[model samples]
Target: MNAYDLVRGLHILAVIAWMAGMLFLPRLYAYDAEQNAKPEPLKSEMQALLRTWQTRLLRIILNPAMILALIFGVWLFWLRSGQGADWSFAHQPWMITKLIGVVLLFGWHGFLAGQRKKIAAGTSKYSGRFWRMTNEIPFVLAIIMVLSVTTEWTLR
Candidate 1:
């Protein structure tokens, strides 16, 4: 009904879209890595298919969703600050921890994008197992971020 509420809803929707891509792209990369075990011709074809999927997902969904989420999240933060929310919240231990988690989330996103660049250059070195292992990062970060926001728990 209000502007902040609408922006918050949109931010949640963007985050969901972005997180879905984050969860999926690494699995696709794992499959792409597995393609290395196939016959040469099949490997090339599968690599091409995977590259297309990666490009489309990044450009059409993931990048835009991330941008939207950041934009709206900053807006919400500013709105709260303007409405007299205490600036000291930023220094709270739980808030600091959540911000650290968010920074790591961005770093993880960059690492995955770098992997995609390597794939494009035919020089990726990471294995399917590695990707599978890293896939849990986003899920874990999401859980921590959600819990921090929902519970507003603080270190005493």
Candidate 2:
């Protein structure tokens, strides 16, 4: 009904899009790796297609969505704190948990980057182990976030 509600709705959607795309991207990288590891080499057309699609996906879609989601999250939190609760960094369990998940999520990105690097260098091979490991990163964070949400303010 109000502007805040509209912004919050869009913000949630943006966060979902960003997180889902980010989670799926590693798998996409694995797919690209398959193509990249062909016997000869990727043809110029194939390379061009990869470059174009990857660039558009990240630059035009993922990055903007992530930035907007982050901004909107900050705004929503500020609104929440403004209403009553005090949100601080020093000693909130949920905050700390979320922060940890964020760090792990960043580390997950490092793994993704490593896979991409190895793929680019023509040294990467995808195995079940690799995919499982890469996929677990986000799942772990999702679990943490879910738990944090459910018990964040209660068990103190």
Give Cα distance to truth, residue 14, candidate 2, Å: 1.3
Best by TM-score: 1
Report the lDDT tens digits of candidate 2 across residue range 1-156.
975787789877986776776677666565565554465545545655654565556666666776787788677666657544676532577867866776676566556556555655657668534664576567668788758855775434
lDDT of 1 by residue, 5-62 (tens): 8988998999999899999999999999999999999999999999999989988988
- What TM-score quantifies how close candidate 2 is to the native fold? 0.69
Clashing residue pairs for model 2: none
User: What's the C-alpha lDDT at position 40 in model 1?
Assistant: 99
- Whole-model lDDT for model 1 versus the true structure? 0.87
Per-candidate TM-score against the hidden true structure: 0.93, 0.69
Best by lDDT: 1
Model 1 / residue 109 / CA error / Å:
0.8
